[model samples]
Target: MSRQLAVMMVLLAASGLAQAVTKCQNGSETLYTSASCPAGYRNVTGSMRSHVMTVPGVAKNQEADRAMSALRMQAAAQNQADEEMDLRAQNAFWNQCLVIDYRVRATERAMQTTEYWSYADRYREHADALRALQYGMGCLG
Candidate 1:
């Protein structure tokens, strides 16, 4: 068992030093494909360019910017709702209610960061972050 453990440790160390995204296609030097890592580990999409969304049929330079703007709008509106709650507590001088609301919002926000957004029309991560941030802002209120 000791010998096996030593061998496994050696293999694990070797694997840790090598992490390469595979090529998107053979002979395609400019493009690289995303590779799956070990189980229970997720690749941060920001580190890899594989997930960039592009609309092939749309031939406009501002399309991407416009789409992003729309997402921002949605995120802002969604987050703003939570702020109103904070304002209410502040106006009423309800410290207990404010603290309780913030605690609940904080927990929800933490969970939202990793939650799967199925119906969001924009960047799901951005949407989640917005929701979380709004709740966080409420907590601080």
Candidate 2:
């Protein structure tokens, strides 16, 4: 996992004033966090740094899980319909590096049932799942 993601796991465990002091400064991404948990404030150290992706945000605690699951399910369905129609993924594009249709000549060595998707598909799917999880946890209604 990326250092940012790992730090997120730790930050998530912390809350209230404690979390407030645990800032992940990117010198770019602007985000605010709520001070509600009881862990108390303290500066976290040894967070990983990167040259490209600057992540910034705070994770909030939600009391309900079932409600979130319902909302996420509904959202996923809608998103899937939109995605299928668009034939697209967000983290990366659906590259046409190879022809999606047609097969080799009759003398071809062999053939597969369906063309393999670009490797980025897995990453995009993971991102979508994570998004659903975070959205579910952060929502109230």
Candidate 3:
């Protein structure tokens, strides 16, 4: 009976020791079942970690930002082109009006020197044409 009791105590002690085992590995894949690694070995199981996983919305938000920037660039280029074209058209019309005014003054001078009233009539016609064009184009109120 004493021998059986001793065997039972040994089995219980072995089982308790087995339960206390904690698996630990080092950088070289060496495993230890103790509280600390021996000399020349470091504990790798506690400090090793993985990076955080990416959320699904982050990629979508980045794509949306890129698209908005591209659209803004396109709109800015278009607006610049429109302003340039508007300036060119305004300069052309201004030059045309200057030429018409010059013609009117020349015809008036000719009428004053030659005693030909027809030149005065031509001046009036040119002035009227300029005024009509300016009004039609919304340049004159």
Candidate 4:
């Protein structure tokens, strides 16, 4: 049993010495034999290339990613500005309509028995004016 174990260990050492370990610089994937390594990859050991050699197609993908990120940020900023403008316009219109409604109601009360039809017409005209303002501001569009 001792002689057989010694023979097995020797065979293992011999086989290990016969193979060359190669590691790709691109992704650090190791290979048992140098011949099994892919064509575009170089060995980590002493070779004719620089250590910081970038893998093919990596730079182009990075550039595209950067451009896409910039475009997304620009689009988000534009959307936020548009939303703020709409909110400001809505608040202004609401305040104006409230004031107009209060004034018209007070006028109706003051002329309770006189010029009722004219007061109603005045309220309709104020409402039409508000609609026109909304349309011009692109709120209705």
Best by TM-score: 3
Better of 2 and 3 by TM-score: 3
Summarize candidate 4's per-residue lDDT along 1-141 as a digit string, tens digits. Answer: 635643643464454432233444556543323344677666664552332122224346568989999999999999999999999988998777666556655655555655567876776676567666655655553
Model 1 Cα RMSD, Å? 29.3
Q: Against the hidden true structure, what lDDT does model 4 obtain?
A: 0.58
How would the candidate models be sorted by lDDT, starting from the highest?
Answer: 3, 4, 1, 2
lDDT of 2 by residue, 1-141 (tens): 445854764565453322332333334542323332233433223353332222233343233456688899999999989988676543223232111111112112122222445544554455455445445544213
What tens-digit string does per-residue lDDT give for candidate 1 at 42-112? 44434434333212222243577798899999999978977987798687655654655565566556545
Q: Ranking by TM-score, best first?
A: 3, 4, 1, 2
Candidate 2 yields a Cα-based lDDT of 0.41
Candidate scoring better on lDDT of 2 and 3? 3
Model 1, residue 41: distance off in Å is: 50
Error of 3 at 94 (Å): 1.5
lDDT of 1 at 59: 26
Is 2 or 4 the stronger prediction by TM-score? 4
Error of 1 at 137 (Å): 21
Candidates 1 and 4 compared by TM-score, better number: 4
Give the 10-residue window scoring lowest on summed lDDT in candidate 1.
50-59
**TM-score of each model, paired residue for residue:** 0.23, 0.18, 0.48, 0.41
**What is the lDDT, from 0 to 100, of the residue 112 in candidate 4?**
60
Predicted model with the maximum lDDT? 3
